[model samples]
Target: MAARPGYRVAVPRTQPEQQAPPVQRLRVRYAKRGRLRFTSHRDFSRAFERAIFRARLPMAYSSGFNPHPRISYAGAAPTGSASEAEYLEIGLAQVLDPAEVHRMLDESLPDGLDVLEVVESPGGSLADLLQASRWRITLPGAGDLNGLVEAFLAAETVTVERMTKKGLREFDARAAVLSLEAQTSGDVTVLDVVIEHVVPAVRPDDVLTALASVGEFPTGIVPLLTRVAQGPLERATGTVRDPLTPAS
Candidate 1:
């Protein structure tokens, strides 16, 4: 566009954006607690980018017109669900001490979105290591939750329908469930669940729907679902180990 006689003409860039490739990758373990649990993954991404800026991190950026920080998120918990274990990886232009980065980022991010741990990634896939999750669901004023669990497990296939971007589809929620048990503490019924990561990842709501169909599920009462841990499942004892730890 031409400028007027007195107006200054804006100069267009002739060169592509230059950005450095990542020299190091750091894996982060964080928690979503309190009201921040309602923050969606997209929301957290934006918050994290801002935190990176505020913390002045030496983040590696992609090359081209729209260069962005090299950050990858794996196994995000569902929105409106509290989580003790969430994971992400960030590529850096310069290598930094994980502890230092952790402190910087923790201070930068908002309260309730806590950075629990940061470690230099060993050579392996973090996604591959996150094979399963241990989840806790609290049902208030619940009765006979143990019976419902037994009924759910006894079934060969417990199918539930969930509406996806593709539309509503039937899913076998029982298949991914490695273990499901309930323990009552006074008036509250607590559910301990270990579910394997599978295609068409099952959410806690799916399990609840399956339970509703298989047994008596308390209506008009919301369940408190929280992901306690995420990592590879130990087959022998049926536990989820920390994903960041390298195998011996």
Candidate 2:
């Protein structure tokens, strides 16, 4: 072969690097009902992962060969009870409209799971800002709910002895209780309470301990417990999807 004359290869110009879209973190509020209520925290997390897979949610993953989805749960309610307020934060691969995400999640969920709200979670994780939670509990009987609240309030310190995994522990029920009030409509009496879910966390059994101290909770029947809201951070603190309203 004839030797070709040496020629310099043309250098290609580098185009400006494109930036990836910003990842979005969102808070999703969902409900647990029916047989699903009995699911433990781990079970719920697993279920959510499967449902997300089924829903084909645009979940963002950590950078690794075996990447995990970026999801964080606020906390879990006790097993075998229904909850109206439960929340989790998930990072999305792409920023989608909150309304659209909400609708999609609702459709993707199995029976007894309801998507209540989807909003932008800014600045803090649910674990950080969740100082307290509100619950409305209804005992089995029409028995004196008002008296129970009054008794619960009058006590200087209500103590509940619980057996944790570590050992027997005593918690001040009064300290956990922020507000306790009673309301009656038709046949049932409702005990609406806002309690401090302190660091170690208070269980529904702890509340029952307080109630049982005042008076017996309707035996054999689990009380109806519904979590209404959670946060130390207010609507003013972050970018909430809805219009701000004064905390009640």
Candidate 3:
């Protein structure tokens, strides 16, 4: 059937991206130090993406038209809180030495966002291992922390309200608290506390609010909070075991 004098057909020229599943997954432990503690999660994400480019690591990308890096972050500390332990995982197209990646990433990022360690993931989810956190809260001019802590522990349920993403809500502050200890020096007091990660996420401020309700805690006292560690809760030792460890 050769009936047309002149006819042409347009054919699209496009192919699917050949992004592969990650061959190697590496978990990284980093620290948010100095003024960089105030960087929001979004800001840190952008900075980390830039660092990946600067380091020139071969990152694995997801399949599709708009491919993106295969990176995931777990249990980021709240904004404005300094942290010694933070965890993230990245998939790589080519296998690389974890130590070298750590060194390169540390060099690429700014001073404050320090790469503490990087290790090959044995198996399982990093987020699942993050069951608890240890924090040191320094309160200035807060009277008699020992008394306040004692009172807080004595309560069976200390209900407090906090403004969350879904508006105002109330939860039991005592439920999330695994342990609390206080040390006083001159006019300052430091609280060493272990908190279990729970729904609604009990924060240090919420604990203080619970204390105020339970005891005659002095007002107008400002506190500096820092997350020391976060990992699986070791029941026997009452400590957070390193999540990067294979056993955890």
TM-score versus the correct structure, for each prediction: 0.92, 0.78, 0.91
- The candidate 3 region of ten consecutive residues with least summed lDDT is 1-10
lDDT of model 1 at position 127: 86
Candidates sorted on TM-score, descending = 1, 3, 2
Q: Ranking under lDDT, best-scoring first? A: 1, 3, 2
Return the top candidate by lDDT.
1
lDDT of 3 by residue, 1-248 (tens): 55466775656969877887999999999999889999999999999999999999999998888898998999999998889989999999999999999999999999999999999988788899999999999899875678888988988999999998899999999999999999889988899999999998999878889988987887788778889999999878889988987672
Q: Please list the residue runs of candidate 3 whose C-alpha ends up more than 4 Å from where it truly belongs after superposition.
A: 1-15
Question: Who is ahead in TM-score, 1 or 2?
Answer: 1
For candidate 2, give the lDDT of residue 241: 21
lDDT of 1: 0.92
Instruction: Point to the candidate with the largest TM-score.
Output: 1
Q: How close is candidate 1 to the true structure, as a TM-score?
A: 0.92
Regions of candidate 1 where Cα sits further than 4 Å from its true position:
1-18
User: Model 2 misses residue 130 by how many Å?
Assistant: 1.3
* C-alpha lDDT values of all predictions: 0.92, 0.73, 0.91
Q: Candidate 2: minimum summed lDDT over ten consecutive residues — where? A: 238-247
TM-score of 3: 0.91
119-229: candidate 2 lDDT, tens digit per residue? 886645466566667777776565667777788888998888888788988878787777778887776777777776674567655777787788855666557776666
